[model samples]
Target chain A: MEGEEQRDGSRGGEAVNGSDSPASLDGIEAILNYEFRDKRLLEEAFTDASYSPENCSSFERLEYVGDSVLNFLITREQYFSNPNLSPGSLTRLRAANVDTEKLARVAITHGFHRYLRHNKADLHQKIEEFGRSIEEYPLHSNGMIKAPKVLADIVESTIGAVFADSNSIDIVWKIFKELMEPLITLKTMKKHPMTELTEMCQKRNLKLEFRDRWQETKEIEVLIEKQLVGKGSYRKKLIAQNRAAKNALDNLDAFFPQFNQPCQPM
Target chain B: MEGEEQRDGSRGGEAVNGSDSPASLDGIEAILNYEFRDKRLLEEAFTDASYSPENCSSFERLEYVGDSVLNFLITREQYFSNPNLSPGSLTRLRAANVDTEKLARVAITHGFHRYLRHNKADLHQKIEEFGRSIEEYPLHSNGMIKAPKVLADIVESTIGAVFADSNSIDIVWKIFKELMEPLITLKTMKKHPMTELTEMCQKRNLKLEFRDRWQETKEIEVLIEKQLVGKGSYRKKLIAQNRAAKNALDNLDAFFPQFNQPCQPM
Candidate 1:
């Protein structure tokens, strides 16, 4: 065990000690299960422009490259496996897997945020709120929760770093195949609450209207046939509207037991 | 030359002859310069769902995969080649290279559409119109001309078939590198006239409005402060609007010499 620890320590150096290293990229290699050939790429991946204004070169480029790599990798996998899947379905499946919420979840699950070098003031609070919000859905809140874009960016940048270091897509895939765990399969994927609610209402010929009180009250209410079915409030009007739609979906059964009954189109 | 033809002929068999063959996939291999190991994939790539209603399979799947492959290939190339290029510029460059019009031009240049098996009416007329329209703007017309989607689909499907056949991205790149010539680079890329018009108008504090006369006369007129500056008509309303914008841009200097002069904000 001592020999193993020494071998690992020798590879990671300052990362193993859990101390403030010169590079400040401690424990990242262990989390990724892959070490970088050029440690600077790793450092760059974690560094945000806000943290070091003097060094304007941030992870945007890496994030961009990583975004393409992730998209291609996911597309290749899903294209071959789902032989009968339509292009539309494939697109949705790919989006669900690599979207901001999904990538943010990946970052949090691996504790990637602990290593991110950013000076954004409200990021921590937003992340905390996201953490709490995700607990309700456990898989994906679709559009109900707001995910910090930086978390997703870091995850992409890390993938970009690995690709740039190795210059081999196969190697990147091998490393990330396991890292992106519990891959959102077609069977496990869920429709956005807004879409679900709209479809349900359309099928039943029920009148659906979103009353916007966002400017005055920062709240959105979903009304069906002049009766308030659900209400949700958020700082962002779009989020509030999505949440209201979700709330309406959740309470549909109790609010209207005859929701399934066909009615005259309004 | 006859011996070489015989050798090539043996490989492609029915695909080589100009006559009706078992697969009806003739002359495609010669055009592409890369023969497929699975001839059925070639046939499938060329086959439209309308051509074989019984099979109910089309080039859509292959086109989807090819679209992904082409996007990734362009991204990888541009990312490495233009180290100083920002993500926004990179995106625009990639889009200029892979958009429907550009790909359709590729199809026409290589005669890839000759082997396509589709039963759509008016396709020939559309292709001919596209051919004539492209003559005016040797490169891209930005948004002035409409491209037949089937032409682009075949190019993507062929690329997808080649990738699937070899299961090697490098091979696909190698085969397509020369085939996809005159790639739109930063130097060659031109902004859409609509975008240019909007920018020019905004800079000059000019109020530009598009009046839709499509329902009455299949025309879209561009008005600057209620004065008619340009008029354009097309079967498609969107195209008509774009052409009106382009016309407005062309006549901007003559119509409003005071455009460069700073004006009071509306």
Candidate 2:
């Protein structure tokens, strides 16, 4: 496995710009504000499977480990800090921070993607689009927008690399704590639009429906009282449904004038 | 929150047998081989929602935290130890160790369930059944048997309680590392019967089907070549399916005798 990993590293290092070099790895270390003891781990973390399809480094495996580490860190942080939070709320809070979009935002914020050695053609475009979309929802879109998984994978893989090299979760937390800025607190976290709408409908004893027109128009139409209350569009059906729910929620005051809805959705 | 927790502790402490008393908590500590700073946390860990539903303790929250902690421990342990494993294999390996059945088995192995302060009548019966069923598959059933969730909950809640009280994952790991004996290593772990059968069918270019007679008979029938290859019964449909697959896989040698299957379907 070590021999194969080294071979993968050398093969991936021989890319167009030699991006997996020692100096290039140092840039990643600079971004993370932490150095690696096992330089190969860092290289492996940044080496996307797209870079070398045949003998790829353990990028996915590192992402897997990093995901579990991040989950543990976030769960521990939330469990202690928010002692009154129910398990359901804690789960959501942790998910908001560790999710693909949130981590992708982190990568963009720290320019972590610039160091990612991937030949994925649309990755940069997707990252740019995600960066632009996040401006509309400062904290999280809550499934309202499509987030390129590669951006998040790089973040997790790097996190995995850091944990693997340091072999200290505290060190990983210290470095990533700030990098993951404005950690989605319970105060900032909002219920996913669909969930809120469903609860509202349940409370009012009203029938709520989302008509999936995704095949035809890549949109989800929120229907209440057999009326098209809201419409939202996205390539992904779930995101489109969330967007539709958000649109309906925004128009609820005028649409359902008699309902006593909470003034602040949060 | 601390005030409420104290109140909950006292309320739950006044149970039928005083199982949540100081002495009982000490027994738990002895089981864990670790004492707690805030004894309330230990009490909360054992207090099931069924014990006093109106204003129960934070057992679920602790379970949530413990689940994440256990996940991280197993992931880190396996990631470094099994460097050759793919992310998929690593996931299955970790899941085999930390899943409800495995955790429930832990609770029963060391008599951890005796301390769980619950008025749930069927809980003991289910635990006994799970204990007996596990004797067949000593390591893990892989969804072959029904392991009562409450049993798993106590294990996780206790783990959470220990972590929260000690404020150290290492301490929790040290205590749990031994309790979770025969930690499902890659060597001992086996794939779910359903998954194995599906892979086998896909490899052999043979279409496979599972007829869910669960509603009528509480059983799943595995049909191959329009022949009833095997059948398995369980209350849970998925477990029934797994059992059916195990039955099918067990009989494949004598039934078909031509698939060139692995000698030991480990």
Candidate 3:
């Protein structure tokens, strides 16, 4: 686990010395548009504990700080931008922006994953699968997809590193605000499929039930008024449940022909 | 609920026009040692939703902002102060400082509750009970006592109002760092009684169990090695459980003579 070249240096600019070349670090810096005063902060931000437990510090502490900073920044922005937004709405909006899937999307979209230093055997495959899964949901999968938390951790840790180095939140905001483009606004934010479906059913006084076949077949079926409206299957029960809800939402018109208005796509 | 005097004036200095006088506001400002740029923010911070709902705004929005600001401020302080602290420890420290019981203690210590404008019928009685209950536990009850959440919310809202007024976190910290005195450090922080009891039992290879009679009698009994060692009863089942755990910790020496070390009092 320890090598002379890997363990001897300051662990700064490890991006250049590790498996990736110097160009990889440069590419990430280009994406961030901010040069690190202490490149070790950057290295620490991207280094996972599984990578080199003895040589490199993990991103957990930075991620912790970054989580708070991002939450406050988003709260401040939305609080002022939407003066009429209630606390509940503000909370939902902030969650949409900073939740695991959203931050993971940010990391993947900017190719920050390419710069992450990790030795976990399955991370590459997980990232590849996440990349493929996200193509189905352009913005957020809500609870349907399980995003690798490491991706979000790196994004937060990077934010934390910038805030730590500059000691100026304004600079951090200026750099990340654009990179986190197309920020999920109230207009674009979608409720989770399960919530939407449940609420719709309740509003219409319709009985809704979910049949759990996940124990045997990894499948979940949604029933409305004793009619089989939707079925979904996935490796994870939660994902299957969410997918079933989404399927029910999509086929709502078919199930209830009297109300033919198409439910908006999530 | 509307009156001529309440409806005519700007809700800015309602603290003076409403139940309390200008002197009360002045006294609060003196306690805070920081005058608000907009007195309305101060008024808004203290106004509960139950008070003058038609004419005056509540502190919910400010509380929301303040909650975020406080979380960030504590995170930043702990992150910088304890360079080697793990994220888990940092989180626990932050939580110890900002949790409802801790913040409520701050409010009670400073007599901030005296100026809260609310129509809560039982608030006065609740505050009195909290005041009396806290006398037994000087630092924190750690889930043993039920602290009124409103007391904590007002403290946070005041922090938010100050931050919003000055648009400076430094000023808010300068004013609050002392008011929130005797901040619970790692040395002073106490684990929840239940957690302590469980850990002790597990360490000693002792079988510990909680017999819940809370539904019928509002009581919880702790048994070790099938011997009833401790029992507690409270109106709240959770509080009863915690007290039971505390009782078990207190009687550990009597139950096991080999280990005579007195358990640390929370």
List residue ranges in candidate 1 displaced over 4 A: A1-23, A53-56, A213-218, A225-227, A255-266, B1-23, B211-217, B222-230, B252-266
Q: CAPRI verdict on model 1?
A: medium
Better of 1 and 2 by TM-score: 2
Per-model RMSD to reference:
5.4, 7.5, 7.1
> Where in model 3 is the C-alpha error above 4 Å?
A1-26, A260-266, B1-23, B215-217, B260-266
After the best TM-score superposition of candidate 3, give how far the Cα of residue B255 lies from its true spot, in angstroms: 1.6
Docking class of 2: high
Model 1 clash pairs?
none
Of candidates 2 and 1, the better by DockQ: 2
Error of 1 at B43 (Å): 2.5
Which digits, one per residue and each the tens of the lDDT, describe model 1 over residues B1-266? 12454335434233122322222364667666677888878888888777886674789889989998888888889988998898899999999989999999888776666677878777777877787788798889898889999889988998899988888899989878777888989998999978888888887867889999998999999998788999888888888888999888788889899876776666
Tell me how each candidate scores on DockQ against the true complex.
0.74, 0.81, 0.82
List TM-scores for all candidates, in order.
0.85, 0.86, 0.88
Q: Chain B, model 3, TM-score against the native?
A: 0.87
lDDT of 2 by residue, A1-266 (tens): 22443333422232222233223566676666676888989888888887875576848999999999999999998998998989988988898999988998887677666667777776666777777788888788888888888879989999899999988999999999988988999788888899999998887877899998888888889999888899998877788889899999888878898677554443
